[model samples]
Target: MSRRFSPSNLFLGSLFVLAAFSFDQLTKTIIADIVMQPPRVIVITGFLNIILSYNEGVSFGLFSEILRGRPEILVFTSSVIVAGLLVWMSIAGGRLEAAGLGLMAGGASGNIFDRMERGKVTDFIDFHLAEWHWPAFNLADVAIVVGALILVSGSFLSPQQDVIGK
Candidate 1:
């Protein structure tokens, strides 16, 4: 089948992207302005803690030294990635695929916005279990991870999406 955009799927994809971007940005803004003023950790649950922290690097704090004082590079790279994902989304075969890609693009754009406007990604949600603490992350990261999982799962589940074989 020729890959094409159904109007309904496109609309749904756009809605998911906009919603993700808005929620991610709003949470980060609130955390930066109101939650981090005094720099104290707030315990929301036994497994989760909210603390304001800045990530100058990509996931897992990678490339902090290389990207130091050079946020434009990060912003540019992220924009390129988001753009690529958007193209993939546009040519995607189904609403599910487009929705997943939209989520990823939105999340990347959110982090890119933070890097452009503030020079760093604001990470606040901290998760831990006993002595093991996962790296702090934000709503954007959540969207990206979940979106990736969806995309990967779709690839595996929908074999007929391939034209040559199933």
Candidate 2:
């Protein structure tokens, strides 16, 4: 096997993937099925609330109208993206890159699993300032964003030769 796909690399990457996926799924289950049984808005702080929402589309509810009731398409698209992430992770040059890719893959997988089983993604984390509120999102979304940020920041911090394996 290639150096990038060494046992240690793959194990570390897989560990992140499993951790992200498990945590995302566990949080979703607890919030959706247990805490929000009655499905009411729960205010935790001045700026945050738990409001159960089902997102039928991609980020910010975009394409929800088109994607609603058509989860198969979303599932297919998301699966493709996850597969690509897995391939990238397998060949990642550094541990940081692999970890980031794994997180993205795991987050995507969580949402895809939701689409397949629930026909939509459950979102509950709500942040607001004054009257304006950001779109509600779940742990998976957080993981994806954090992973992307890590990858971007890593690129800037690491030497080009190290990242590119030159």
Candidate 3:
């Protein structure tokens, strides 16, 4: 059966995205303006710390240095991607799918906002094991990753399996 793109679903998806975006932006703003100067770090363990890090790159400062020095490319790319996602979300169906896209949109929007306004994204949560340290990340990154996982997992469930006990 074909799925119809309903207004209520669109609204719900948009609302979720907006909520996520707001939370992400607010946290980043707080960290960038109030927390980064002193750079407060809460040691969760020997390998994890909640430390404020202003990253200009996409993830874990991978392209941050390059993006930090050249903001135009990053800005343009993010804008296009975000716009494309929005368009896709507008027509996407399935409850989980809509929710996932909303999360991705919101997370991307939040980081994009930071890149545009603050010239970097504020990353606070850090994890490391042995010599390998993951890039510092924030709520938005978590949301995006979690949402993507949910979407991927959901894709594996057939309609019959979703409707009945599998």
Candidate 4:
């Protein structure tokens, strides 16, 4: 069967992506508004907790300083780049890649929306060592990571199989 781009595929893929985005945004809003200060951690162990936080950074709190404090340049640049990626994913990236692209696009869009609306992305999940802590992350971060992993793994998996003595 030939794999071809189709409007139906794009629409379905976009729907999944948008659904993920909506869920992430909805969760963040609930945490931000309903959750109390220090955000009632649901302790799983010494290493993990669900505590509300605001992350003004690229993934894992990188470039947080750029996101925080400064308002114009970095935010605008990030927004534009992410928006471009979403457009590309919507228009291109056929069925196999659609889920991954949708995930990445939706996640980036969700986080960008958060930053634009609240000036920071709401983060809650946290893990730590005795003295060290991983950066707080949220649903969007999870989606991005999962999508990236899938894309990378798929790249490795979907190659031509070499055969000998046909």
- RMSD each, Å: 4.0, 3.4, 3.2, 5.4
Candidate 1 vs candidate 3: which has greater TM-score?
1
Which of 2 and 3 is ahead in TM-score? Answer: 2
In order of listing, the candidates' clash counts read 0, 0, 2, 0
Q: Sorted on lDDT, highest at the top, how do the candidates line up?
A: 2, 1, 3, 4
Angstrom error of the Cα, residue 73, model 1: value is: 1.0
Best-to-worst order by TM-score is: 2, 1, 3, 4
Q: Give the TM-score (vs. native) of candidate 2.
A: 0.91
TM-score of structure candidate 1 = 0.90
Q: For residues 4-68, write the lDDT of model 4, one tens digit per residue.
A: 55575467558757977998988887776776455587777999887888877777777887667
* TM-score of every candidate: 0.90, 0.91, 0.84, 0.78
lDDT of 3 by residue, 1-166 (tens): 1256656546766886898899988887776677666877778899987787778777667866566667667778878887876776666555566677788888888887777777777788889998787888998898788768867876886544332112
Superposed model 1: Cα runs more than 4 Å off: 159-166
- Candidate 1, residues 122-161, lDDT tens digits: the string is 9999999987989899999999998898888877756356
Superior candidate under TM-score, 3 versus 4 = 3
- In model 4, pairs of residues that clash are none
Question: Candidate 2 on 52-163: residue-level lDDT in tens?
Answer: 9999999999999998899999899999999988888888767777788888888988899999889999999999998999999998998899889878877776444344
Give candidate 2 misplaced runs (Cα > 4 Å).
1-4, 159-166
